[model samples]
Target: MAHEVPGTELNINTTSNDQSAEVGNAGGVASAGTVQAPVGTASVSRKRQGSPLEAENPWVIDIIREATSKQIHEELKASFLRGEPDMSAATVFFAEVNQKIQKANDEHGAERDRGTIPGDAYEKLYADFKTALEKAKLERNEEAALYVVQETHSKFAKFNQEHHLPEEWNINPDAFKHDSMPEVAPKPEPQDNDSLFSGSLPDYTGSETDIPDNVSTLEELEREARYNQSLSAGEVLYWWKRGVGTQTFVQYGQGSSKTYRIRAGSYEVYDPESVPRILSSGALSGDPSSVSCQGKQKLQYRNEKGRIEEAWAYTRDQVRGIVGVGWKVDDDDEEGIEPLDLLVPEPYATYPHTRILVLWVDGAVTLEDRAFIRRITKGSYLNVARIIYHKALRQEIRYRKAERLPYEHLLDRMPTRAKEKQDIELGDEEYEQDGEELNSVEEVQPEYRGSVQASTIRSASTRPPSNHGRSRTSEVRFVEPALEPRRPTSERGTARPSPNRVPHKSVDIEDPRDAKIRWLEEQLEMSLNRNHQSSYDSSSRWRRYNRYDGRQSEVSEYTPEPRRRRRAVHRERVWDNWTGSWVTARRVY
Candidate 1:
């Protein structure tokens, strides 16, 4: 029991502690009062030096924190696993003992049967133990009360000594009270108007409380700051330029679909008993293409093992510091956890919630959502628009389920668990009989099989219907087999003429080599005859001139070699000996 502090209604058995502890419990540490570490941070004990209250009585807080932590751990574990203590047997045993005690009591210090302890003896021992436990508890509470009393008395004594009244005046209760009717104000002596500007109407032109056109109350101003668009000076224009934006957190499967608001350096210590500093911010930007960390800051958290950890603390600008080089060019795909500049404080429009708002992680916030969470007493569900930045288009696409066509949605609303075809391969088939087997499909011959060099020519032919309503069969129609046998791969030249082909007759039937010899002989003969005719004509001319004047007549300017073409000895041109006495053609080997 703790000594009660005056003027404070503090309860030691506080159940509604904090949400950071809730997050920790979800992580399996098991304390609802546990202060949460920052996102991506571990909790440590050293983080509490920043707190003045805990620094004074750390030991007391730690003791309570340990017990509560254990309690919450067990409770949450039971809740999750649905485990319960085995109390039935214990209760039954207790009842039996109580019955035995009662029976002994009814017997007046004697057992009804032999070999039994007397009721008086059993009752005395049990009652003594019970009384001792009750006494201990009572003494504890009394001690706590005594401490409270002492502290209260000491404070009052100190205060009284410092600012005490006269003993005679303060000793009596009636000293501070009115003993008689309060003295009434006496009537002023009859007098003429002594006031300045007398008989003149006072200037009351602008003193009247005339309501202004833009009359706004303090509450209305706060509502505007937190719930409505800004109505303050220059803020509306600033917001419009900033554009409407929302945030979303995607922590794999842990997203609660709830938004949060956090601030930087709220100085929340990371202890099981400390309040959690949320990992949220008021960062928003109409331009998805750009993020600005104009103002933001970082905070720290601790863990049970008492280690310090850090994370992106909080920021006012909504861009989440994406504009910072850390996010724009990190080594990894994630923009990652990095501190961003905090936003400047505003007068009234303050967001009040867990500042665990994460963009693209968990805790999504939408511009369409109310500016302030606490003031939102009523709401109608609105479409949640997710913004996707199309880098190539340099544009942001705002998409929501409500904007989709009905046909765009999938017919299967449930998740699909794909199974390999190998698993349960015959799930669809029914077993008609234990030994029955499926009919095997007909196998085609290798000849009928398609290949690179050949293909089975498919042909259709009508057949009479079977006895059934309609019948179908994959029948091979009569396709003419090729008449020509396939050429032997071993043969080098073209195929021999077909035996069925009629032979065409020609006058010459000589082998190609013999034909070549004969054709060359004929060509040589024709050339010789033409050469002989020319020679004869020249001789005739020469004889006519020379016969009349013997040797005196000179042969006209032409000379001729004695030539009858040599008998054709060879057909092809070949090289003759360079030094041969006579030039001669030789047949090619």
Candidate 2:
């Protein structure tokens, strides 16, 4: 059958093997329906000329544009109206019409998967066509829908292989499993209740249970136990489970009741070499099920690696300033009363030296409150009194008025200069002499002044009569009596006349009149006689003596000594001159 194209009014060939093979025109109207028999199964061609991306085929576009609206309407009904619709009959109808259209249009995404329709088409077919198949199955065409499902899978397979798509694109083989599928083994049955609970807890082979022997000694552990008044969390748990003694008690107080599972055992407490294991215990987490003694609740404990460990536990309210004060309990005041009893007290019963008790007494009291409690409360019944006393005890006390001055104050009061000079033995004698010199110089200056004037008068008297004659030496003291000479200047000042200037005998003396003069006189006399004898002997003896003489005499006729060749101004300059850079210098005697 053929139909007219819209807008162009062209007629195109449309009849194919099945009546379903009728095309809709450019008017976009659907084809008439008709029933047809299924075609023989066909394998998809491995060779794809390229994907059906064809606006390339002129024939396909012409066919779509020429077929009329009425023709498409008749074809669609004819394809499904037959006994039962199958893959070949349905595919052939759409193939001759829509396939050619898809091949011609790039926008249809025909190239997206080889041999398969685009995603929109696949979705549209699944919804629309699947619905129709379901309708057919309801109308006694169940075989038709099953056949369509198989064909859909086959089409999808062809699409994956032709496109070289990823393995994930392939349909899962498990989905298609039939009678040939393998069976899986069944899971083991759970054990009975008695068997499960009857089993003993496994021994902790994963880690060692016993603390190392090297951790601490028994004595150290005891000391720590007494000091801290408790055991460690691990030790507490350990003892509770396996220690020598275990006790149980139900405590009632503070508007609540708790059960204590107490354990007693000797635990090593001090490990000087190990890092302190401060624990928060169950008390910190507010578990209310367990209590730990000798533990730092909410405190940081460093291991050897300096990491804060989470494995150990302790209480949160055991801090010193916060003890008995910070913990939250039922029926407690918003501002809690200072607890009379320590909910968690120090392990050691004895109080610390620095502790002091502060008591608060309420006005209201009953006989029972006074009597039965009096027996227990007369002393420090509540640990709080003892703890407060122990925590606040004073070490020393002194009355304000009786107290001695502080060391710094005593130092400040001392005479600084006097104390510094006390060790100086040289100072006492010096001050005495300094005083005497000052007094003598002050009081005796006039007498010394009078003596100086008298000496001037004597010196004036002894001066020469004004005749230009050489003055005779007069003894006059120019300096003090301490500096005056013992002898007169006329006899002692002049050097004694020596016969020779150079004396044979050496005499050292400050005054020229001493032994130097006598030695020089003896040398001069011997020299004079010897000179006379030598002069008389003369010529022959002189020649012979000259031959024997090694010492050369200096030339006596005042022969000018050959001028020493002056070091060429500067020896350093000679080298400089050789290098063409001589420096000038002044002549020196």
Candidate 3:
């Protein structure tokens, strides 16, 4: 027969009948003894035999105790291969042990309630379990060390993931191996001076020979500077003197047109040479009258004592008057044309006859013919008057104002207005005013040299008092111009006022000091309203205490509410897994 123990699963067997009878008696005695045993004593004996925690789940403690480095490595490898990120054998082993410890405590509490265990039983068991773990750690065994290393690496990998650190920052076990060491390059030898600076030095001995002579160089530089200054000032006289001149003669039967050409930067002819060529080519033979000289003749002569002289002769006064009409020379032509004689007298005097004639027609010759012509004969330069014309068109005259001699105006004792008509007939447009329409110069005002004060006083006395100070002496108050005020056409409320209407007050007319004061007052009011609104809003957002009922209310003002007691907040530095740094965690009750 086999009989089981009271609180345990162990069974005892009897071998013979006598032994069975003795066992039965002993069982009865044991049963009676167990019932009479003290609760603390029974609990102590049960603990001595085996802990209830181990009895319930023995594998948890057995795995922790019997773990090896090889087993841990295999488990870690398997876990990695299985792609289990957060789970590991070491973490599981500790978790199960902790659960077993919690269960032991719960059982100890139940035993204490049934009067089987003492009140301090759970505490004593916890202390014993902690001692065992400490003993296992202090043993310096391979499995424990490997578990620590693996746990550290696992925590580091988790920290890397949580903190978003680079993967290279994580510990790699393979990197620690001997085969993973990197090779270092050998140190270079110190270089000699010759080897360091390998290139040859430049030869600077012959540099002085490249310099030029100072006097000629300075003259050339001055010439260049003068040329550049002339260019910058746009002095056409300089270019005109430097220009080359030529002549083209086209004869059609007894009539011919002599055109002049001048080349400064470009070629400019007095008349188109192609017109004569085209007409002489028989293209216009159908109209023979178009080729008539029209009382104009081109006379060319050369005397034995004088140079070649050319002139355009007009047989009729009407023909001469028709040429170069309504044209005038610029006021600065004296400076532009006279400077060439002083600068280059030889060239100015001995230049080609054709060039001189072209210059005269172009209104560029401010001097007399004697300055440009070497010798003059009656027939050599006959019928050549001081007539100026456009450089590009022979018929368009360029008039110039006659030079006034000193005291020349004293000879004319007539009134200035009397001569204005004569000046207008002479084509003096400069004297014409812009806005005034001069229908006839004969319409002149009567000369009144009387005192202006007398006339002003008489005019002021006849006008009304309202117009006395407002009317200007220059303006006639008898007649007012007929101009109607414009009215706004739009009927909208936002229509702008008529531009002619004078506003009572304008922003442009407002005094800056008064405007600043008004602006400051408005800003002050706005700030006050803003502060009041903010206070009201903040008070509404939070709970407002009522003095009478000690409850929340809509009103912001309260009569001396009690101050809330401040609790001491416990602050501790805890490791933040996500941030991978220590942060202050606060606890308040």
TM for every model, in the order presented, reads 0.12, 0.16, 0.14
Model 2 agreement with the true structure over 242-265: per-residue lDDT tens digits: 334332111111111111112222
Best by lDDT: 3
- Candidate 3 Cα errors over 4 Å, as ranges: 1-63, 66-87, 109-589
Selected candidate, larger lDDT, 1 vs 3: 3
Ten contiguous residues minimizing lDDT sum, candidate 1: 383-392
Model 1 alpha-carbon miss at residue 10, Å? 99
Descending-TM-score candidate ranking: 2, 3, 1
Please give, for residues 1-589, the per-residue lDDT of candidate 1 as tens digits: 1132211121232233443432122242214322223233234244334534242233233222333333433433343233222233323333443444344333333333322212243233324433543453455443443343344334434432332111111111121122211334566898886779676954445645764556677877766554432111111101211124322211110111111122122111122123211222434443343322212334688978899986544333332211000111112121222111011112232222212222322223222122221112122211000010111001000011212312112211111223312211223233222332221111000112235231222112422222233222222236453444355435675344566974332244679999999999999998754432344444466666665423322543333445655554566555557775555566633
lDDT of each: 0.29, 0.32, 0.32
What's the true lDDT of residue 528 in model 3?
A: 50
The positional error of residue 478 in candidate 1, measured at the CA in angstroms, is 47
lDDT of 2 at 202: 46
Span of ten consecutive residues with least summed lDDT in model 3: 250-259
Runs of candidate 2 exceeding 4 Å displacement: 1-65, 68-72, 78-87, 98-281, 284-589
> Which candidate comes out best when scored by TM-score?
2
Ranking by lDDT: 3, 2, 1
